[model samples]
Target: MDQNFSIVSLVLGASTVVQFVLALLMAVSLASWTVIFRKYFAIKSARLKTNDFEQEFWSGTSLNDLYQAAINSARQGSPLQRIFASGMREFLKLRERHLDSTTLVDGSRRAMRAAFQREMDAIEANLSFLASVASVSPYVGLFGTVWGIMHAFVGLSNLQQVTLATVAPGIAEALVATAIGLFAAIPAVIAYNFFARDIDRLSIRFDSFTEEFSNILQRQVAPHPGQGAAAPSAGPSTRPMGAH
Candidate 1:
């Protein structure tokens, strides 16, 4: 293979449309990778923080103390912490109003639900772009390949006779687009799948936590038989509940 026919040379020698496609694919690949790296770290950190909060929540810590800690942590708090805080806050406010157990639980659940949605939006950010790149990059590369082949054939039409030597370069140049396309698509697809799974797992965890927390709140608010209204407590259960 001549040095002139190297991958770099073939790319540089590609037709204008082919070059444009290559550039577009490369840019998309770069952006996808950036999102992948950022998402990886963000999700990892989220999981770790959730774990820490779970341990603290179930460690017999008082709800008031945990709520104060969550408040102090502010924006630095994990999704789980924020969700807990939201529910606890609502529960306290409703409790002060002398709301029934059902009303207290429902209001706290709504507040937690809103916080969960916001956290999910932040957690799943930029995931759609990864999905788009995964699904579309290959076709973009194929477009470049087809265009390169058409251009090459048109060039060959100017030659009186064609030989293998003359045909190979054009074919190779056209194939390079497909190669680059696969290169870009493979990682994006893999990362997309991985992130999707992680997000789903996090969602499940959040849901479980919400239900368990709600149950704990319900238990505290529910009045004892033959007794008057009982005071509500925000402390977590001694054992974690099995997920449904």
Candidate 2:
């Protein structure tokens, strides 16, 4: 069993550096797989939650009611819910201070923008590492292969029994490192591209939602006569006689 499992037999006469390279490739592959699975679930859950929240939001629900619901279900929080809460809270704060419509909209927009950036940051975490692994692993593997080939030639120079059979095994073993590197890299590259596209789509959705919500608030603050504006409109008929 030991003879069958010797380095020369198992690795086809690979050098120590070549074996190390293969091990490194395997480790990177395992790490990338773990990240892929984790991000897969995370993105899926985020998308589902975002979709659910958007449905509830556009169903004529009250903003305060939706915010309360989101707070109550914080464990299932979505980016859209968080952004809505931030914007609404800011708008309410400005309303409480008796600020004008422009100020209120500005404050709420700022809050929503901040919330959007925060949510994006959370969604994009660890993606850079995955991307780096994808882009660099192949080159790393090729370096290992070059080193292995150099070592093989050096070994042949010292040995008098060099032949086609003797050199072929070492070269084959070195090529294995490159193959393993590519195996680790390809899926990581594909997954990174997929996740990046999904993130961009989500970002666009968030931006559009922010704009729509802002428009809703603007209309609310500037309602027609007898409508429920936060503050009464100033007019000769509606204002007190002594008012400025």
Candidate 3:
């Protein structure tokens, strides 16, 4: 048989339900691939940007200068930058008020936590859909295959004798549903898993940066040599936000 009368013809000639199932699977597979490509780039970019920011942060540059740059790039800053900006901004505001070290730390922590949640939410967008496609696509394809086989056997009941030629086309068409289902599911599953792992690592990095920033502030909060003897007086909290 020519190529046109093979699987292509089988699919084209499939029952209405089987054809619908195949069409649905193809659509899902296409959509899943789109998400896979998009998410691959997005998560990778986020990780790379986070690494670059972390390097810049610990390079002993002045905090105020970094904070200023962060503010300027606020629109395009990575998750790390956003979290730092939120904490540092709150720290600066509280310090200007002459709040005690403990209160300053608390406010800064709150600010960073809020910012962290927002960034994480952005990173996690659409992951659930990928997961859904991965988990459900196979079953959907199996449903199509089963329906196709039933359809073939239904036709067989009308024949006087079953032959390979009579049975092959129906089974072949039925199997296409499963093939398309696997095609849709496998990439989605792989991409979803890859993103989950990468995102998790990024999450850990964000957490570590937050804690380290808080510690730097905590050090500034402590009294200087012999200053503990006198009452604590605050003036911009020793410039952790401005890191002289």
Most accurate candidate by lDDT: 1
- Give the per-residue lDDT of model 3 (tens digit) for 1-244: 6674577898898899989998898898888888888888888888888888877777666677778889999768788998999998999898888878888888998899999999999999989989999999999999999999999999999999999889988898899999889988998888889999999999999987888788777776766776631222233332345554
TM-score of 3: 0.90
lDDT of 2 by residue, 1-244 (tens): 4463454574655778778888888899999999999998998888999999887776656676786787777656898899988988888888988777888888999999999999999899889988999999999899988998898788889888888877876677677788888999999999999999999999999998898878777766875788645642222322223534
Better of 1 and 3 by TM-score: 1
- The estimated TM-scores of all candidates read 0.94, 0.87, 0.90
Candidate 2: stretches off by over 4 Å:
1-13, 223-228, 231-244
Give model 1's TM-score versus the native structure. 0.94
Worst 10-residue lDDT window for candidate 1 reads 235-244
Reference-based lDDT, residue 196, model 1: 97
Q: Model 1, which residues run further than 4 Å from truth?
A: 234-244
Q: What order do you get sorting by lDDT, best first?
A: 1, 3, 2
- Candidate 2 lDDT score at position 238: 27
Better of 1 and 2 by lDDT: 1
| lDDT minimum window of 10 residues, candidate 2 | 232-241
